[model samples]
Target chain A: MSWGPLALSLQVALAATALATALGVVLAGVLARARFPGSDLLDALVTAPLVLPPTVLGYALLQVVGRESVLGRAWESLTGSSLVFSRSAAVLAATVAALPLVVRSARAAMEAVDPALLGAAATLGASPPRVFLTVTLPLSRAGVLAGVTLGFARALGEFGVTLMLAGNIPGLTQTGALAIYDAVQANRDAEALGLAAVMAAVGVAAVYVGTKLGRRRVHGA
Target chain B: MAREGGALAVRVRVAGPTAERPRVDVDVSFGVGLTAVMGPSGAGKTSLLLAIAGLVRPLAGRITLGGSVLFDGSGSWVPPHRRRMALVFQHLALFPHLTAWQNVAYGVPRRSDGRDRAREWLARTRVAHVAERLPSTLSGGEAQRVALARALAAEPGALLLDEPFSSLDGRLRLALGDELKDLVEALQIPAVLVTHHLEDAQRLAARVVELEAGRLRSERPEGA
Candidate 1:
């Protein structure tokens, strides 16, 4: 409900969505394109975050990037930034929570593209990279759009990971979801209700768009 | 892995499941003109074309076009795009996002003249009127014609078609067959077409190549 925390949440959520979408795409592309031993294991690892407890994930992030660990030390030396209570940390937690959804949608979209189309592109003298860029990517555009938006919405609404990893720093790491939580504790029902309504709207819109885009191309796709 | 060749020598070794012979090996040398390949379902006919087009990795054998070995034992392999040959898949994998003309242009090498060549090919294949339409919107016959135009637009060293007319109605198939024959003769590029319909091939190809299991007949022409 605090204006400062609410504003910060919006900014952090937007940045988190952007970073996560980009990372998710690269990750999804690899998951879709590559084949190797233990591929199933790799898939399980990617999707594990969806079902795992957010607090556990936050702890894991802290262990690895919490100022004392090697990665944390590298971040501190290079950027003079400790992730805890920082906007970047909020973004990281949000990304982890939303990554699997984006990747799964992207994978399904890429798979739905007819294999024959790729073969035909090759026959028409398109190099492998050309075929993917020209044919595969365009065909999967809708799915990618849906995936990224869903990821963004998920990240925007994440509470537990954001709270534990980034902490509830006003105007820095406190997201709208986090703002609502704090408002409830402070007994400010009005602000909490407002934030909840906004989050619900965002969640509904993202879900609607994702489903429509995916279904529009599902048949004759 | 034999590379002994006249013009085009292809040896394919691959078999689909449920196939009596999983290792259907086909060895054939084509000189010129369209060589129609006829066989029943699962006769490894499509595999032979895939091997020739450099799409399928033959279990073991060799394929050479104009004495340039595309594939051979051990380390010899050529990428399909570099093979400079066009293939018309049975499913007609037209670029759904592009207009028919754009699809044709995709086959032409990127250059200043690419557009003009694309238009010329479209006109030759008689799909110029519908060049602006996306492949998704085109009728089955129109899509096939656009595909043919795209293949010819490449000015490929050869043409390979897997069940080229399988989707067409009887009348359309016969008409396209006649038109296709004329197109191939005018270009003078050798070709291979796969089909379950013997009558269609007989009308189009000058020579008929038959495959049984994976083995090609010693020397014979059936129907086509």
Candidate 2:
């Protein structure tokens, strides 16, 4: 079996999960703590991807970052390459598909942290940033870790958005899921089965790890 | 400017959650000793402490610490971190993820021998041997001591205790209160202890202030 699809799949999922985790953590922190008008509306928008059609999300991405869009034009000019139908495009697709998983899980985790602990930290002379890094972030480790794992699993299996934004370019944009699709289309049953097994194994592993992490609550936390 | 080791004057009003009692007000001052704020449940004693600690915003009034303007009605308020005050929570809230030593060291600045200072405070509070233990591993009394040590390790300008002995048994509460009173006196800083128990308040402070229905009622010397 060729290693190209597996390698590309891992690369895209890793990049996507990393991006999602970064954005998700900051967004979750704010969402968990802030009380302002329209906070609920903003929360719904962030998690909207979970319920929205993947193709619709992909179409939205295309309208904003497609080759003809301003961002895409600038990106292409700077990088001397088109943004769509590339490995980075696959990463972008995977990121969008995985973002809601990260945000929902992380926000829940952050919200579970006791406000009293934050109050104690502040009284002990820790600034807001210090309190978050030293107290809030450390205490929310289980949720953050679980969120990253779930996001990675989602990214690994992302198909619809990827097909729309990054197309299945063999040995390039073809992730494990995309490769399985290609194999089945050509009636390559053995290759399809192999790729499917690999994807399933990855998904199962991610889910198992995430479950264990999320369930391991801290006593007195 | 306020004098060093001077009093903390608090005269503030905060909006409560309901329309019936639209506001809660606190009016008091502290010199260099423990001042217990005693009240029954829902009397807003803790709210007064929170406002002084900068954890809550007051709708009007001011809190002056050692003559410095900690908060003023004219849109001037210092954030909690810069307030130079330490609060010991009833539940202890001893950073469950950190060991006793780490929790004590948390507020100490990284510079100026903070680790040694933490160890010193831990020893002072009689919890030096449990320095490596997590909060969950420690008993209620041990955790309380650690909380006190952590607060003192910060070398704060003031200290606030919110029902610090509420979790302990009756016997333990008295014993711990005696030890705490001595500790607070040794530190020579203004301290506020909020408690629903009259015994706890009288045992720990020479002056006691009473609150009822979100309003400060009376302050008197221990016997009165």
Candidate 3:
């Protein structure tokens, strides 16, 4: 009945969602607009995380950021600690797990924007970046919000990757999902059920909000 | 202030034989007055406008506005936002999320009085009453005026209108057309009006050019 895991999960999920949303929206905008050779290949790479197994993704992450790796060495030198098995690792794991959902949703939304409207903005002497800020982003707000909501749900539920990278350190890296797992394995059925019910409720609420936002059309379009 | 001189000189070939239309080859110049472009559907009228506005890249030839070379057969090219051209799309294309004043404000240069400038443009276009409303709630004529206000607020070097009055009733069309004529005259910037209606062409333009299958077919002075 300890609330530490639940609190840690919320903290990790919020940080992960923020990181995912920033990177995902930019990547989605690039994928939606920029035309170049191998653009489709690039898109496939971004989407690969969604279809790949979490264990596979975790392994890949370990290779990139594990101790003795360049990033890990750099982090240790800079911060006096290894990055793996830390709260930051949990955040990274959740970010990667949540990214594809945001990217896919935001890309579709951006692509759906009327090209004519973009042209009109340009003709009004707004630069490309200005047009994106004033026209493109506002027009696709709902979709982006939906993606962020879904990404939060995904990030909160992340267990396999979190376990692999962050490990289940009580009151530290152990998030709600890992706590549920730990509780069940330790025969703490009441604790497990309580955490599971809360997780389920949050997940459902996030998904319901996401769906509603996704279905909303920009008024006056 | 009306621009004293510098016509938009265009001599370009746009390569396109899409499922809907043939390639466009046109050589024309627009002076400081309204020039109407008339053609049947799929005649590349929109393509020509897009090329001038720097939205479409032409395969060959050059486009010069006054002394500034916007595009050339070579690598010299200017992006759309730098072209100093304002195009009012046929569908109006007002930013749906913005109120009428904000839509116009978007085109106003960044300055301390930008909002006031936007309000002035809206009043000039007779849409000041609807300045706070989103485009969706505006009537057809109201939307058209808002679009016009947004375009003019940019203080562009040239103005382009694509079937600007197509959706309005006859009376409203005439009224808006007259207002457009006065605006273009006052600005003294080369204005290109693309329309399928001959009457509209004759009424607003000092010169009219017809296009067919993406080529300039004929040119005539208004009333000729």
Candidate 4:
């Protein structure tokens, strides 16, 4: 009924989606083209979060960025505050949860592009970045868009990681998923159901858009 | 060391075959004219072109274009885009997302007149009518011309054609081959044409070379 948690969730999801999309697309491109030693290992590492339990991922993230860790210390020094129980932590958790989906989908899409088309662009004197921008990105737009949409949906519903890293602090870090959990614990069935319905509707809409975009083929391919 | 004539010289040892192609170890050069490379399928013809273009690293070899070293087994290497060699792929890999004119314009140097130059090349290749069409909508001949136009628009130091006419009907192949001949002569740059057809080799090449099992089997002047 408060709507505050819903607003916080939207904010966290949007920020997480932006960060995840940028990192995911770049990592996907590298994985799609590079064939160096340990490349497969690197890919597996990126994909680890997808199959790993949320609690496991949360524990791993805590080890890397908990209050006593080096990154946590650095952030505290820079920002004059701890990072573990804040909105930023929530954003980070969602980003990590959302990233693998984007990376896998975008990588498959990018790998599907004709190598001959890339070769032709190079022969035309376009630099590597130019070729990626003009040819590779345009050809893979559908997949990238789909990945971003899916990432947003994932970030929106992120519960376990967010609960672990960014504790449920009302009006500060409590998102829609966290709010639903809090409502059920307090025996507020009506509030819990309302939040659940909102989350489900938004999640379904995002998935529908993502699926449509994923199925949309490039005209000439 | 620089070669005497401004020819494109290639002497490379490519690794032996895979399921798709045989080993390719070739040492060949091209002057300011068309030199057709005749070979059988799976004979590593495409590999040779790819190596020369710097798209494939050779086990041991050197490639020099005009007076510049494009590749040396000792570690000197120029990337494909920097080599200034335009290759029209066997499948005519035109950018599907771009219109015909845009594909030609892609290689044009960033200048105020780049689009105009692209239009001129389209007209020159006689695909001006399809300038706005995507590669998928164009007929085979139209797409071929568009690919050629895109290559020539780059004003490359050398031209590499991989089975340029293999997809066309016999009559269209002959006509396009003639047009290609005239274009090569007018451009006066080293041109390498890869074809399995003896007829195409005899018709367009000033000199013809044969590849078998990934090695150069013979080299002779045209009609020899």
Question: Candidates sorted by lDDT, descending order?
Answer: 3, 4, 2, 1
lDDT by residue (A82-133, candidate 4, tens digit) is: 8898999999999998998899889999999999999988888888888888
lDDT of each candidate versus the true structure = 0.80, 0.88, 0.91, 0.91
What C-alpha RMSD does candidate 2 show over the true interface residues after superposing them? 1.4
Q: In candidate 3, what are the lDDT values of residues B8-123, reduced to their tens digit?
A: 99998887866344478889999998999999998889999999999999988999999999999998999999988999999989899999998898877665667998899999
Clashes of 4: 1
C-alpha TM-score for every candidate: 0.92, 0.95, 0.97, 0.97
Please, what's the RMSD in Å of model 2? 2.1
- The regions of model 2 sitting more than 4 angstroms off are B1-4, B110-112
* Clash count list over all predictions: 3, 1, 0, 1
| Model 4 regions more than 4 Å off | B1-5, B18-22
Each prediction's DockQ against the real complex:
0.56, 0.72, 0.87, 0.87
Worst 10 residues of 4 chain B by lDDT: B1-10
DockQ of 2: 0.72
> What 10-residue stretch in candidate 1 chain B is worst by lDDT?
B1-10
Say which candidate scores most in lDDT: 3
Q: Write the per-residue lDDT of candidate 1 for residues B128-153, one digit (tens) a residue.
A: 88988888788889899999999888
Model 2 lDDT, full chain set: 0.88
| Docking band of candidate 4 | high
TM-score of 3: 0.97
- Screening candidate 2 with a backbone cut-off below 3 angstroms (N, C-alpha, C), the clashing residue pairs are B2-B67
